[model samples]
Target: MERWPALELASTIRHDGDGGVTDDLATVQGTTRWIRAQSDLPAGHAPAGDIAADEELRTEIVALRRAVRALFARAVSPAPPSPADARRLMPADQALAHLNAVAAREPVAPQMDWPLDGAPVTRLLSAEDDPKVRFLAALARAAVEFLSGPQRTRLRACTAPRCVRYFVQSHGRQEWCKPSCGNRARAARHYRRQRTAADGGPAPGGPS
Candidate 1:
């Protein structure tokens, strides 16, 4: 399976009910822990151990997350970007280009191994240190690969209330990220219908 740690990194923020957001990566310690936890998650082949998080590193992480989020927003939205949005997207565009460049420079080759019964397997030959910047660069490359691949069309932003995350839709009927999110969305719709009825207004999607 392809690893896309940048997606997880981008999901560190959650929507608040009051038009705000909560940051899971709010602290340097939190950022360090999150990066370390990546190795434990399924499909996460990132190296184990905590990332170094000085003030400068923390700022870089924040900026990387912002760039990832902005790129995702542009990809997921149907509308074309306005002039302002176009300008705002410049940094993200540059970041993604840099990531692709880094990954391109890494050595990759196919080799036969006993583990695969003599089958040739492709591997990343670069064994670089886990500097904070390099770690984030790895994630950025994964994100770029995923977003550019065929699976990009399957990407969906979760519509669950107070949840800000991206998910790959496995089926045509799937919408929300999880069962709980679907339940909450359904209940909210029902409640809105009841309120509209009580107010003698047209029910949503019913009549004009």
Candidate 2:
């Protein structure tokens, strides 16, 4: 699947498989590892090998992630936000402001490169000298772009039990982030039906 920096950031907080949430950016080392693992980020956005994350950088990145996730919650609208941070989501207005502020930290201009043997490519040229600033700004900019793009309409919070993911629906009926989540949800429903039958309640899908 195609990767989006903003989506990737939001996904840092996910199910830990033990029926609890785990934050991938919970520590400086973890944050550094996460940043390094994002090899698919656009050029100029990915940090160099020597640029390890510090406490300040980790805090900034986590803050940006909070705003992105809050905006993602808004994008999904009436649907409940991811259970991981739903109760603590930043307000939509505050999140929007924070995202814009972070995105503006690095000034960038589109530079077009045309070669005789290949198609023209456009890349951003940033005025910011600090690599850390550039990285954070790039992430914020990606979130801004994603929120304003058509794909925002397809964003949905996974409803499967123990799942806390937000995924772009590939099909009209897509309800889970992946097939594993779908299978888990189905099994959960089956278990609930069996329990209800044992309790002498109405059968699954029957009149209450």
lDDT at 28 for candidate 2?
98
lDDT at residue 186 of model 1 (Cα atoms): 94
**For each candidate, C-alpha RMSD in Å?**
4.4, 1.3
Q: Report, for every candidate in turn, its global Cα lDDT versus the true structure.
A: 0.65, 0.90
lDDT tens readout by residue for model 1, 5-34: 766777787665565677767888877777
What TM-score number comes out for model 2? 0.95
Could you tell me which residue pairs clash in candidate 2?
A: none
- Regions of candidate 1 where Cα sits further than 4 Å from its true position: 1-3, 16-20, 40-46, 79-95, 98-117
Worst-scoring 10-residue span by lDDT in model 1: 79-88
lDDT at 22, model 1: 71
Q: Cα deviation in Å at residue 172, candidate 2?
A: 1.1
Candidate 1 TM-score to native: 0.76
What would the TM-scores of all predictions be?
Answer: 0.76, 0.95
User: Which ranges in model 2 have alpha carbons more than 4 Å from their true place?
Assistant: 44-48
